[model samples]
Each structure stands twice: as structure tokens, then as C-alpha cells.
Target: MNVILITACPSGMATTFLGARRLEQAAKRLGWQVSVEMHGELEAVTPVSAEAIAAAELVVVAAERVPEPQRFDGKRLFRAPIHQALPDPDAFLERAAREAATFDAASANAGAPATATPAPQAAGGNGQRRIVAVTACPTGVAHTFMAAEALAQAGKAMGHAIHVETQGSVGAQNALTADDIAAADVVVLACDIEVDDTRFAGKPIYRTSTGAALKQPKQTLETALVDAQVESSGAPQGGSAGAGGGARKSVKERGLYKHLLTGVSFMLPMVVAGGLCIALSFVFGIKAFEQEGTLAAALMQIGGGTAFKLMVPVLAGYIAYSIADRPGIAPGMIGGMLASTLGAGFIGGILAGFLAGYSASAVTRYVKLPASVESLKPILIIPLLASLFTGLVMIYVVGTPVAAILAGLTQFLNNMGSTNAVLLGLLLGAMMCFDMGGPVNKAAYTFGVGLLSTETYMPMAAIMAAGMVPPIAMGIATLLARGKFSQPEREAGKASFVLGLCFITEGAIPFAAKDPLRVIPLAMIGGAVTGALSMWFGIKLMAPHGGLFVLLIPNAVNMALLYLVAIAAGSLVTGVGYALLKRGESELPAVADAGSGAVAREQRTG
Candidate 1:
């Protein structure tokens, strides 16, 4: 019999191709001619031809999510879980053939794209176990797919049925079904960012990073099989994996920081995009918004009007998401809108997010409902109650106080002439580098960006200058003291300089994560110097962000030459400081540890 198999997963890595090879071998051994197609995130997929589809007697789909499946409308099809086709591929193929169902061409092709009718749950009745996993990374590229492959391979070797869902940059490939989660003995979450994990509510879950899974897949699987927890509906095992290993820190201790960072991470892109667009508008002169039908006006509308407006609501919504997953989005956004209306700025957005997040979480945790209407908790009750609670608090209690403080801060910054401005710049600069993109860094950024609405631009200028120092400084340091950095880090430094010029504070994250104690203090000192010089020179920037690149726009920065001088001075100081201070050989691993859990190792090195 002629057979065709498609192996597709997010990240389209080893998980897809490796499984395809195994499945092809299994089919060949079963005396059937088989062809396989591989779909991966990074690699180009070889499309299965229409001729191949038409000639096939049977098609087996072993994937977490198949992007398009309508082609097999008239064929006998089998939807097998990922793990089924790996180790004992012969058995899996035989079983799939026995269970394959013929599709009605007209009926299947009539409506929405034909979807795979999931096969009945594997009973694990043949002395095999069942497992399900979700693998993800911040970039959702290599590690995410590799981890899925590792787990699948290990599980197959152990004669266990495994299905891995990959969350990659392109999107989720093989999405887990409710039945898969239900029948699984355990759920493995090998990810570096927050996932929609609430789906695994009552399931036994084993949590770790993608790196951990790649390194020790067998251990991860073995541990999951034995020590997984039946998670609560309220919070996932570790409160949203904050930056680095900091997630392990108690919510009571770093919860505010973690949740705030989550909001900041989501909010920053809007700030950067809006800020640059607004800066671009300045090319048509400062009052470009007043002009109609001009590129300047368009930029203003996009930068100042749309993205800026959405920034606060998005911030609040994601913060709530971090706290209470998807259920918190609506309430948090509403709360943020109220905060903006009340003139509360970023602070208000933050408050609204936390309030909405906690309130939504509380509803999910405490507001028990009948099993018949339990679905209403996430859909109706949590959002409704959280929105109400957050809205009320933001409008009444939080808004007034926060607005007053923001107003005071804005007034104070406005009144500063030279010395006061310099001091403030120094503090803001120090804060920017102290934690690289952490709470303190974002706090200063938020304050500076918050003042854009009030037409106060110097603080933002100072903040940006300070923020740029860390990455540029580290990059310069790497060039000057190559021996202090590993080969890969030196390459990273070249990239850091470019990112630094673009005002991406995250470029310094790797250096800071490697040796916070040595790197951070030096960064802070340099940033402070840059910030103070920008303010003392009375230099003002009209744009909220965008480093050197924004200077290309006319009138974006008031003293472009002086601004460059300040950045150079700061970079030199930081580079010289590192050259003088950093002791011993570079401890940077040959392979950069990109995992969030790597922070614990950084702590040890420090």
C-alpha cells in the first residue's frame, strides 16, 4: 500500500525531520512505500505534491499542530500523536493503519479547512506509558524544538508514548488537544517565558527551562513521570518565570518586580516604536502634528496617537496576564484606560495591571462555581469582577495619589535648571544600568517616557543617554580588553554596540547576567556620567527614545555633537573601569547559557 506521512511542529527542527525519518523507516519495514514531508520553523519545508496526496492510500499525521490539512479530504487518514512514530515506528504505523478513517471529500472540504479528528487516546495498554509536553523559549527557535525532539526521543527509547507541542517564533506548530492533556500521565513545560499553561490545570506538571530539557531530557522526563504536581487553578508552579532564575524567588519578595517586568517587557516595544515615529515626525519640524496630510502628521498619528495610547492599556493587560494568565487581559486594559484618563501615566498603568491581575487571580482562586458553569469563571466572572475592582481602585484610590505624585515629579524635573537636573540625571542613569533591563532600569525609563505627554524632554534624553551607556560601554570594554571576554562574547559585543546605538538596553543583559557584581556597578557609574553630562550641558531631546539614529531627524536632539561626546565619555570610562577592575580569566561558558535559569549560575560566579 502507498502511504505518506507529514511531520510538522513549531520550530520545524529535529522533532519534525527526525520523526519523519523514523516513520519512513517504519513504513518501509511494514512493506509499504512511504514518503515524508518535514516542516520546521527555520528550515524550508518540502511540500507534499498534489500527485502524492492523490495517489496515497493512507496519510498519517503525527504533529502537535498541522497548519493546513485540507488536502487529505478524500483519503484514509490517521492522526497519530507525535511520540507514536518515533522508537517503535512499526507498531505505531500498524496501529494507525488499523485505526485510519476514510474522509468524505465533499463534506470535509465544504466548511472550514478540514481538521484532524483526533484519534482515541492511546490506552498505554501495551506496557507503554503516555506523556505530553510543551516546549518554548524566548525566541522560540532552536532550543524550543530541540527540547521537544530530545523529550520525544527519550520517551520513545523508554517505550513511552509522548506528544510534544513546540511554541516557536512562527507560532505553535503541534498544539496540544484537550484529550491529549487529559490522558497524559504528566505535562512537561520546558520554557523560558510564560505560556498558556492554565490549560494543564489539574494535570501533573514538571517545570524547567528549554536548556535543561535539552541537556537532560531523560532526567526531565523521568522526574516528570515520578514527581510532577497536579497544579492548582490559581497560579502555575512558579509564579510566571520572571527574568532569569529570579522566578524561583517568592512572589511576596519579587512578585511585584516580576509582574512589573512582565508589564514592562510588553510595554517597551510600544514605547520604542511610538517614540521613534514621533521622532521621525520632527523631521517636518516640532509642530508637525498641526500639519494635515503630511508624512509628519501620519507619523504623529501613529507614534503619538495610536501606539502611545495603546501602550498603557497593553502594559496593564499583560501584567494582569502575567498574574492571572489570559483571564486578566480585559480587566487590566480597562483599568489602564481609566488610569490614563485620570492622568496617572505609567505608574497608574502599573497599579491597574497589578490590581487587575491579583483581582482576576483571586476570582479564579476563591470564587468556586458549579461544574456545569465552571467555564464561566475564565470567560465571564473573573474578567467582570477584576475589571470592576481594578477600575474602582484606579479611579478612586490609586488615581488621585499616583497622579499627584506624577505631577509633582514632572514639575520638579521641569523646574530643574542645571545642578538639580544633573543630579536627577545621575540618579536616573545609575538606575538604568543598576539592573540592566530589570525593575530599576524600567522604573527610570517609565519616568522619562512618562514625561513625554507633559512636553518635558530632557529627562527622557538623560534616561536614553544613560541607558545607552551600558551596552556601548560593555562593547567598548570588550574591544579594549579582549582577554577579559570569551570569543563568543567579543562577537556579541560587536552586536551590542549596534544595539546600544539604537537604545536597546537589553544588549547589556548578557554581560550583566554573566557577572552582575563587576559589570553592573561599572555600568551604573558610566551611565551616571553620561546622564549628568547631558543634563548639565542643558541638552534637550524632543524624542522620548531612539539613540543615535534619531539624531538623523532634524531638531530631534538639541545638541547632537555634545550628546555624542557625552556617550563617548561614558563608554570610555566604563571600558577603562572594566579594563582596570575585572579580575581573573573570563568565566563565560563556551556556549552562552540563554536559559532564564542561568541567573543562578551568575549569582554563583559573582
Candidate 2:
């Protein structure tokens, strides 16, 4: 028999390839010819050719989501969660062969091309609702696709005609068209990050997180149907388009956090470029750049003089944009530039961004104009008035006090004693591991990044070191106590190790989500240890991001050997702790089941 297997995951880091390998081994044992296609965050690896797909007797998809399902239209298809395949591939394959059904393109409209018409509702009569949704997460990986798949499955089972557009790291797939939006009875946005809802104006919209959608998809759908409200055509109620007209009060706070993160995301590239350039200049001796008309001076000019100068403005501008859309950009950037010139730094820039965004949104909503001149509101009137207001406030009110505060803070950090430094590091480290990549982690990261503007590098070093500990520790724990983790988790640990080396904290999320009680505390202890060590050793990092690879660049990190030791020590602590604490998979079934359910609930609440 000829079999075509497709596998995918959010980041394309681990599960996709692992599932393919297991399925291939199982297929080979059964003496079947198999072709595998793996989809990750970017693109497909060794995608199945049309000829190969045509010749296959069965197409099995083990993924959080199937990328471009239309490619296999009319084929006999079998779908299962990627985890199901990892535990027992032989049994999974047998079920695929026995239960695969002919896939009709029209039945699963979510993955249909833009031009495709809506699928007919399931056998139930007129009670079926037409729903459209978009799912996204901060990393644009795991939760994004999981939520999309869950909603699709739930909608199908409940006799609803639903289509989901996934906004993953690779960009939007199966995007919603004008026709789809117009026809939908309600729209659901399952996102942890801000998304453009301009096109969704006038539609009944509901906002939620990916975790909530994944855990209680049926309930989420019901809630949306009942509580979703029609979005207004004007500026959003609380400076966020995603916060629809009838959104709950808590949404306003969530919107603020998302807007701040949006700014940080835009500012990161500039920080990395500028920091690396400064580091490169230090290679010629710390004072080399002081001598003008040289390569070191030129590098410093590009990195410090230009990129660093623009970072605050870009951050403030994007934050405003996330809150009030395009009109807020000019005011926010202008305010940010003023903050920089006045020495108020990143803190002032953040304040300026919020002020500008809310002012712009308020102006847009309240200002009235004739029909002929209404177009001028977004293009001319809004920018001019908002910029004036934001600029005046920054210069006359906010800037001087903020500058003084920043100066004092910088002085304190520069002269801090070792004990104080270690305490600061420990606090930052614990915060980083508290929620993986959630708001607390981002808050710690944003604090470190902000300090870069003040020429303080120690905190940045501590933050990165602490952040790297979790995934690396998880990987080590799996190795030390292999019997504690399931097959899927062991494979995930291997991927987590690689991701940790790259400083992606989300790598340990799978382990944490499954066993937070044991994993989180152990990881936090390791992070704290690494952070304290980094501070005590007086290690300094010039770059804001990059993991172990930062050590390769000359002068990128000071006290590099000690830095590595700090990271290794932390990983060892967490690894050994978790390995001893974790329960073996062979433990009593009832206990395991209860533990699993509790962990699932915790993940959902979080």
C-alpha cells in the first residue's frame, strides 16, 4: 500500500518531524511505501508532489493543523492529534488505514481557498450558525494552531458552518475574504496579541485567548453566539479595535498589555542591531570609538548614534499604532523623540505612547466633520492636533521629572553593591520563569531592554541567562529521568534544548503546561540561581537577544566564561530537581489521570 503522511506543529521545531519519523517506522514495519511532508512555522519540508499524493491509497494528517488541506481534496484522509501518534504509531497507523474517509473539499471550509464558497451546514436544520474566526498567539506557534483546530472540530460536530484563519509566524493562512466576513453571523478572535480588526467593523465580534478556545471550544462558540457585539465604525471604545463594543471591562486591561508588547516587538530589532554594533566597536579597545574617522567610530555611529537614537521613537510609535491605528503614529513618535532629547529615556517614551494613543483615539471618535471633509480627519486633522497635544505634554509636564528619575535610577544601578545586584537579578530571574512568555516574562524583558538605553548591561545578561534556564533544564530532566516523561514529551525535550540554546523560553511550555506544580518551581529555582550568579560575577551583555550564539561575537559579552558557568549551573539545578520530583509515567493510572486533569485546568485559567 502507498501511504502519504503529513505532519505539522506551531513552531515546526519538534513534534512535526517526530511524528513523521514514528509513522514512517510503523509504515515500514507493515511493508508500506510512504511519503512524508512536514510543515512548520515557515514552509513545508519535502512537500508531497501532486503525483505522489494522487498515487497514495491513504493520506494521514497528524498535526495541530493541516496546512493547505485543499491540496489533498477528494483523497481518503485520516486526521489525529500529533500526540496520539507518538505514544503508539503502529496502532495509530492501523486506525488510519481502517477508518480513513474520503475528504470532501466543501465539507471543511476553514482551509478552503479564498474563492471557495461556504460549506453547507451539517445535517441539523435551521439552528446552524455561520461563524468565522481568527486564532493567534504571541509566538504565533503552538496555541494559535491548536485553538484553530479545536474550534474547527467543535464547529463541525455542533452543525455550524465555521471558517478559521490562522495568524501564525508564517503569516496568515486561509485568510478570510470580504464575502466570508459579510456572510458570517459572528466573528471570534482567539488571540493573545493585537490583531487588525478594521475589516471586521460592523460585524458581531467576540474576543478571547487561544487557551480558552482550545480547552472549551464548544463553550467559547456558545459564548460568542450569545455575547458577541457589533463593532462600531469609529475608533474602538477603549483604544483597541479587538475590544468590540460590548467587550468586558477586563478586555481594556488586556488591550493595554498587548499594545505595550506590540511596541516592544517593533523596538527589539533596533536594540539588537545597535547593541551588537557597540559591542563590535569595543573589540578595538573600549576607547577606540573615541578616536573619530576610524572603522570603530563608524560602527559606533551606525549602532549607537543612529539605531539606538531611533529605538525609543519606533517603540512609542508602534504602541500608539497598536492602540489607535495609523493616526497615532506621528504623535507617539514625536513624543518619543522629545523624551529622548530630554533624557527621560524609555519610561518617558512608554508614557508618551499611551498619552498619544488615547488622545488620538479620543479625537478620532469625538470630532465631528461634514461628509466632504470627513476623509481629512484621519489624514490631516488627527495627526496635527494629536502631535501638538502629545508634544506639549512631554515637553512641559512629563519629561523633566521622568528624566530626573531615570538619572537617579541609572546612578544607583551603576554603583550598586553585589548583594543588591544579586537580589535584583534573583527577582528578575524568578519573574522570567513565572509564566514562560506571558505578560510577567515580557515585563521583566521590557525592563531589561529599557535599561539598555541607560547603558546598564548587567540586568540584560541576567535576564537572558535566567530565560535560557527553563528549557535547557527541562531537556536535562527528561534525560536524567526518562521514565518520568511520555514518548512525545521526551522528543519535545530534545527540541526544547535546541530552542533554549536560541533563548526561546516557550520551548518549555509543553512541559510546564502538563506538570506546572513540579516544573515551574524547579525552573524558577534554576533561573534564580543563574541570575544571581551572573550578577555576582559582574557579567555584562551588550545585546538584548540571542542565546549562546551571542558569545561568538567579540566583546558582545564580558566575563563570558562565568556567564556560561552561571547558565550551566542553573540548568543542572532545575534538571536534577525536576528529575527527582516528577512522577514516573508507570505510576497508578488514577493518580496520573487526576493530575493531568488538574494541570489542564490550571493551563486554562492561566
Candidate 3:
């Protein structure tokens, strides 16, 4: 059979090429004529000609993401994930051959599209259940779509109605409607990144990692539906939910975490803009803003006067938005402003956000209005009532204590600066690398972000530096100890270098996930060194993020030269440590699939 095969991945990196190579070998062994086309991170390579497609009897698509499937409308088609195709290409090719032979080419050419593999359909059951789900991952790539596809197939097999919304690099696709959401018996959130789930309030939510969905999709869906049943009936069906489920409480806390992270994610851009601008102002001199009509003064005005001043309010408003959607924004902003005015700082902003959000939600839920004026509740009543309550509580109850707490925090930071810089740096740095972007890493990051408003920037500098260390160190280690890592890992290391410089500590997750014992300790050591040096040099960073780019601003860091030196020193330490500690490839596991499903290692090879 004449076949045209296409391989695509998020980064168009190693997976695409490896999948192509695997398929080619299989096709050759099977005595089939096949041409492969690669679609990758930046662009297409060795693209198949239109003539090739027209002449081919079959088309095979191997991708985590299928781009423009309709292009092969009339051809017999077979599809699988690009990663899985690498491990066993011969099986896919054999299946493709059988499918192509059975498919009707004449009917396909006449008008109807040829579908070799029928989609999964749910078996008839007691009752048809409708499900709505969202799948997301940190990199917005592979795992997002993989999980969605898995869940859809699982739902089909169980004979349930399912619609999956994919939030990926291409953005949200097949988005769920309000009516659809309302109708669903349960909402499945398969994600590693924090997703806004306020819309699913009053509906039972089931939380699972993207990996879980990929690995055990049917079980994941079954658990969700069963939990919903338990919640609705107030009794466990078959005792499964009763035995292993605190599902409701878990879901509730997951929703809360999502809200907070949403706020932090939204607040980051403002911090970057304001901090960078303020840093730029120092280029013309420390007090350049005092002198009018200069570029530096304008930058200072825009960055410090406007952006910085708005940061806390923006953070709080978004947090409330995550909780109560649009209705809570006004009260949240007002509360944040009050917190700033009262010198309660970022901690106050967080409290204001939660207060405003919960108050707005309560008002929306409890306040009854005439049907004729029900629309007015969102526009007029909720905002008015929530605002008043939040404002009064902030002024009367929360303002003074929070301000005093903030003052105490500031004093503690000052003390650390003089007496415990190294210890503080070591602790923060280790925390940053400990779980990558998990709770520990976030705690360190949040602490640093909070300190920005207080002008205690040394901690922020140390945190950023330490966070950058793991990925860069891993990249350097790969280079220094070539025999210690597999071919695929080395490819991933190249991508890690860029990610490290961008302050994405999650870049090291692949290496650490594969061999945490060897990788994590070395990473922590490197991170600690970077953090200690940053503290020792008294490096101050206005921005909570930006990595090396932040160093470009003259006044952003107190000691730019030393900061670079520290990063280099840390990277070297980690690289040498890995070289000394890790045995040759004979002792290490093969790195064929080292990364979590979400990370875009494909970008590295392509």
C-alpha cells in the first residue's frame, strides 16, 4: 500500500522525528511504500507533496495534537499519539494496513469521508449520563490533548455523553456552553495547572492529574461519576465512594487552590511591567524621577507611579473574579486599595480578595430579588452589598492587625538581611527546587512576590536566582557528563537551557521525575549556592520574575556582575556534582520517556 504518514508534537522536537523514524522502519519491514512528513515546534520539515497525498491509498497521523485532520478527508486514516508510536510502530502500521484494505476508497472519493476506525460508543446502561470536562497542563501542550482524547474514548466506551474542552497552546477548543455545563452530572478537571472552576459551583467536581487521565481514563471517569452519585444520593453506590472518597472536600480545596493560583498568574504581568520600568529608571540615576522631562522619569512615572500602585488592587480583583466571577471585581479592588492605604501590603491584598469573593458569592446566593429586578442583582445589589461589607470589615476589623503583621514581617526580613542571609537563602532555594512548581515552590515564590511591595527585594533576587539554578544546572550537567544521560535526555537538556534562563524551574521536572534521587539533591545544592551568593552580594530585584532579562535593568539588581558569577558558580557545582555522582548509562534507566506528559521535550530535538 502507498501511505503518507505525518508526525506532529507540541515542540515538533524529538518525538516527531523519532515517531517518523520508527514508522519508516516498520513500513520498510512490512514491504509497504511510505513517506513521512514532520510538523514541529517552529515549522514543518520535509513536508509531503500534494501529489504524494493524492497518490497514497492511506494516511496515518501520529500526534498529541492533530492539526487540520480534514485535509485528508477522502483517505483511509489511522491515528495514535506520537510518543506511543515510537515504542511500537509496527503494530500501528499493521493496523493501518488492515483498515485501509477494508475501507471503501470508491465511496470515499465519490463524496463521503472514509472513516476506518469508528469512534468509541457507550454501551447501553441503566441511564445515560452526560459529562463535561476540561483538560489542561502547565506547558499547554501534549498531555492536555492526550487526556482529553483518553477521557472522550473512555466516556464513549461506557455509553455516556461527553464533551471535553482542551485548554492548550492553541487555546480553548470545543469550549463548553453554560447550558452544557448546567446539564452535566459531574465536571472532570484533569489538570496540573490551576484552572478557574468557579463556574462549576453547585456542581460536583472531580479532580485528577492529566497523567492519571491518560493512564487510567476509564477508572478516572468512573470514579468521578460514582462520586457524583454518592454526593447526590448521600450514600455510596457499591461502597467504592465510601471506602476511598473524601471527594467533596478534596474538590473544594482544589477549587480554592485554583482560585489563588489564578490570582497569582494574573498578578505576574503587572509585577513584571512595573518592576522592570522602575529598574530602568535607575539607569539615569537613583532619583531620576525627581528630575522632570527625562526618559527615566517617564519610565518611573509609568512603572512606579501607575503600574506599581495598581498591582495590589489588580491582584485582589482577579482573585475575587476567580471566586465570584465578574461580580466580585469591584469590591475586591476597593478592598485591595484599602489594604494598600492601611499599609497591610500583599497579605492584606490576599485577605481582601477572599473576603470580597466570599461576600459577593454570598450576596449572589442568599439575597432574594424580584424576578422583574433579578438582573439588577449582578449590576447593582451584589456589588453594593459586598463592597459595603468588605469595606466596613477592612476598616474596623482587619486593617490594623494586618498592618501590624506586615510591619513585623518587614522587621523580620531586615533582621534576616543582617544576620541570617545565607540560612534564609539556603532554605528558600531548596524550597524552590524541591517540588519544581508544586506547593513548596509556589510558597517560596509567593513569599518573594509579597516582599516586592514592601521593598524588601533581596529575597526576591535570591528566590529567582535559586529557581533558575535547577534547569540550567541540569542542562550543564548533561553537557559535562554525556555518558550519564540517554540520547533523549540530552536533547531535553538543550531545551532546559532556554527554559532556565526564562525562570521556568519546571524545565528540570523531566530529569528529576526520571531519577529524583540523583537529580534533585544536585539541583538543590546548585540552587542553594545561587541563593546564598545572591544574598551575600545583597542583590535586590524589584521584579518577582524575569530571570536573566531582569538583570538588563541597571538598578534592578544591586550587583549584576556578582549575580551572574553566582549563577555560573552554582551551575558549575551542579554539573560537576552530577558528573561525579551519576554512573554511566549502564547503571541509569533509559531516558526514552523521561518527562511528564505535559513538558514539551519535542521542542528540544526539532
Candidate 4:
């Protein structure tokens, strides 16, 4: 088959040529006729002739930004990311040939040129500043999405483009893109689990804990693009705190986690892919409760079975890429398989692969072995160790506890209204208001997700509503009376309202942190009231995270009206009380914002 290929990475960078060169090399090995064109930055070599694109049996585009399929009009186009080809020429040709042959077979039949488009290229692309977040917690549910929601709100409020990639029990949602990284001015990582930031190389990035971002979003904003490399001047290799390691100071170099994180970033879909598919399988296919028909069977075949099967390999493959630089794929795949067998899904598989790679690395480092032993690293040493460790830990420790907790939660929820309904709501709601996005907030979230197993989502929904209102109401009040907050604080209010609507209670952190005395109680009062009310009126929510945005997704929120009311009432009270308590306009910032000063206290005379 005759084939013509064009390669172009996001930056229109060198990878474009590399991909083309790789494909050409592959075709050469197979003794097949092929032509390659290069775009982006080609130093001396020119692209393949346009005539080739016109005459070829198939057109292959290894482009980071896949041009709209419409561009290739009648050409048989097979497009993939430039990464697929570069540095591995032979494999590229083989894959290209396979795709071309498939297209040829199609053309032989009653086929048109070939259907071109793949899933969406980019929807919700143009956000402020293009921030990419990997939100997570060990539990993979409540705290994960809550923190994700908080960070997204924070990003939007800061007027920066943003894309939040959630890493939770429900799996990843809104995966980040290379374009997202390239276009971003800043990266705010509000997470406990590791988030890969290597893609943000050369871009300013603020790595902060979820709690910190939620509680001090404005301060977080300060650290975002402007402060990741905090000092404006030739900043010290490391910041004053020296929080990062030695390798970290060099913006040019990345460490173990950096590489691993790269793969984790890509592996996000596996978690989601597997989980959502399995959920659909159970929902539509299995009919665990009763007999299901073809619809359920079909859903499981597409959603559950295949996607679930692909989970670990994808996770491992990406992580290996992070490590050993290029050659980690084989080891990563083997390790990933091992991880899956241990019941360690996507996130766990990543960890297993990393361990496998490093251990194989150690064997290479210490052992005076021959070249033959080297290949064994991937097929033997790496996979064996990673799989064993992952399996043992998952089954005996990680998986057991998780299963027990989930089981307990499910059982409890099933029994919730059966015994202590009102009391539970009050407790959960109070927790929601307790510290906004702190550990207290997470506890409430976990309870709700846990109850999800029992087919109960009300406790979580109420808690979320209660936790969301106080900050927004306070923001409204402050906006209404600019006299009640400092200049900076007043500006922050703009962000707070947005965060509040999104159910990010931590948006009011500055106010609460600065004036725990008056602000916290008012916020708490509103939050508690909101939560209690929501619980009294049952509300169901589907998406694990996001404030109101989650409301937009299919079957996202049940009893939306009541949920809105609960949040509104709480916000209103909080706003009114906060506005009234604030003293002089000048005093507000000193009282409510951490970055601002204390109210100039009047000196008492002797």
C-alpha cells in the first residue's frame, strides 16, 4: 500500500519531523512504498510533496493538534498524536501499514473515502488561563471531587483558563490536554495525591494542598502563574522554604514523580473508563438485582467489559513512559497487568509500574549482569516484583480496608433513614459547615459516597449544599456593601461568589482565616442551616464532584430546586450577618483577610 504521512506536534515543534521520519523508516523496513511530510519546525528537510497527499492510498497525520478532518477532504486519513511515532521508527511503519491495509480493505468494499473524526477534539477548551488540575484523595470520592470543584472555581475566579481533571473513585472526568498545558499561564495543583506537572514545563505553577487552595484561594491565586516561581528577580534555585528536592530547583529537570505523574495524567481515563464501563455494565447489563435484556447486555459489552479490561495496561504503560524515559512501556504493561490482578486498578497500577521500573533500575545499577539480563528487566524482574508487591498489598491491606469501608458505608446508608435520618443530616450538615473544605468537610463527603453503595445520596447532597452557601452569601453581602471589606478583600469577593455557587465553601477562607471570631460562626450558621434543610427535603446528585457544574451533567442532580433553596437561604443569612458585623470599610480587610493587616486597634490610655 502506498502511504503519505505528515507529523505536527502542538508547538509545531520538532516532533513532527520525528514522527514522519519514523513512519518512513517503518515503511522502508517492510519494503513498501511510502512518502512522509513534516510540518512545524523542519530545519533542512522539506515536507513530502502535496501530490503525495493527493495520490496516496492513505494519509497519516501524527499531529498533536489533529486538524479538523474536513481539511483532508477526500483523502483516506488515519490520524494519531505525534508521540506515537517519534523515537520508534520501525513500530510506526508497522502500525501505519496496518491502518492503511484496513482502509484499503474498507475501500474495496462499498466504502466512501473513510469516516474521519474521532471523539471530540476539545470541548470547553477556552477557559481562563487554561489551568489543569488532577484532583484526588486516597478515598477517590468526596474529598477528591470537592477539592476538584474548589480548585476549578478558584481557577475561573482568577480569570485564568482552567481544565480540572478529577481523579476519584468514580474515576477521572475532564482529562487535561497538551494544549491545556501549552496555553496555561499557571498551574494550580490543589491535591493530596500526586499530579504530574511535567507538561507545565517553562510555565509558572503553584503546587499547593487542596486545603490551602480552598482556604486561601486569593493567596493561591497569588502563587499561581505569578508566584510559582515566586520571586520576580532571578529567584533562588529553590524557594525560601526549600519545600521541593534538589532536582526540583532546576526547572529543566524533573524527578521520579514528575515522570510517573506524566503517565498518571494520561492514565486518568483508565480509572474512569474502567469504572464508568463497569457501572454501566452493572446498571444496564448484569441486572444484578434482576434479569436484564439486550440494552444492558449491549451497554456492558461497550461500556463495562472492554473498558474495564483496558484499565491496568493503560495505567502501567503511561507510568513506564514516565520512568526509564522511553523504554518503560514493556515493563509498565507487565507491571500494570500484575497490578490489575491484585485488584489495584488504574492509580494503583501506576504505583506498581513505577516500583517495577525502579527496581529493575536498581538491578541494573547494582548487578554486574550481561546485556541478556537487561531485557529480562521488563519481562522478568520488573513485572515479578511489581506484581507481587501490588497484589499482596492490594488484597491484604489496601483493597480490604477500602472494601470494608465501602461495605460499611453501604450498609449504614441502607439503615440510615431506617433509624437516624434527621440526626444524621444534622450531624453531616454541621460537619459540612465545620471547617468548610478542611478534614471535617471531607468526613461528611466520605459518608455520603459511602452511602451511595446503599443507593442513598441524600446525606452527601445536603452536606454539599450546606457547605456551599455561606461563602457565596458572604461574597454577595460584601459586594453589596464594598464598605464592609478592604480593597483586596472586596476584589476577592468577586471570586468568592463564583466559588460559592460551585459549592466551594473554602472560597470564603480568607474571610474566615482572618476573622475566625465573627466570620466563621456566621458562615457556619448559614452552612448548617442549608444542610439541615436540604436533608429534610431529599435531594439526589449523580456526579461525584463539581459545585453547580455537576448539576449540568445528565441526571446530575435530583430535587435541584430544593437544593438551590437550601444553599440560598444559608447564603442569605450569612451575607446579612457578616455585612452587619463588619466595622468600618478600612477595618474589614484587616479583620477578614489573611494577606491584609489587622484592624488598627485603638490604644487604651492608662
Best-fitting candidate, scored by TM-score: 2
lDDT of 3 by residue, 1-606 (tens): 788778887533446656777887788788777767766422224345667677788888787533445466667777677776777889888876666443344444444222221111122235678899999864454557767997999999988899999987567899999999878877898876556564665666677766567545787787576444212323232221111122332434445666666667667678778888888889888887898899989998898788877878887887887677678899999998999899988888889988998898778766777778776877889889989998899999999999999999898886665448888888898888776666567778888987888878899988999988888988888898888678998998988878889888867766764555567778888888888888888888877777898877777887889989888888788878876776676643444333311111222221
lDDT of 4 by residue, 64-121 (tens): 4333343356666666677767667677666755674223333332232212211111
- The stretch of ten residues in a row with the least summed lDDT in candidate 4 is 597-606
Q: How many clashing residue pairs appear in each of the predictions shown? A: 8, 0, 6, 15
Q: After superposition, how far is residue 469 of candidate 1 from its true place, in Å?
A: 2.2
TM-scores of the models, in the order given: 0.59, 0.70, 0.64, 0.46
In order, the Cα lDDT scores of the candidates are 0.73, 0.80, 0.73, 0.57
Model 2 TM: 0.70
Residue-wise lDDT of candidate 1 within 32-125, one digit each (tens)? 8666665543233445667767889998889864435567776898876676678788888898899989866556434432122111122333
Q: Candidate 1: TM-score?
A: 0.59
Which residue segments of model 1 deviate by more than 4 Å?
1-193, 199-254, 368-381, 482-492, 504-517, 540-546, 582-606
- What are the per-model C-alpha RMSD values against the true structure? 19.3, 14.7, 15.5, 25.0
On TM-score, who's better, 3 or 4?
A: 3
The pairs that clash in candidate 1 are 11-41, 12-40, 12-41, 64-174, 64-175, 65-173, 65-174, 65-175
Residue pairs with clashing backbones, model 2: none
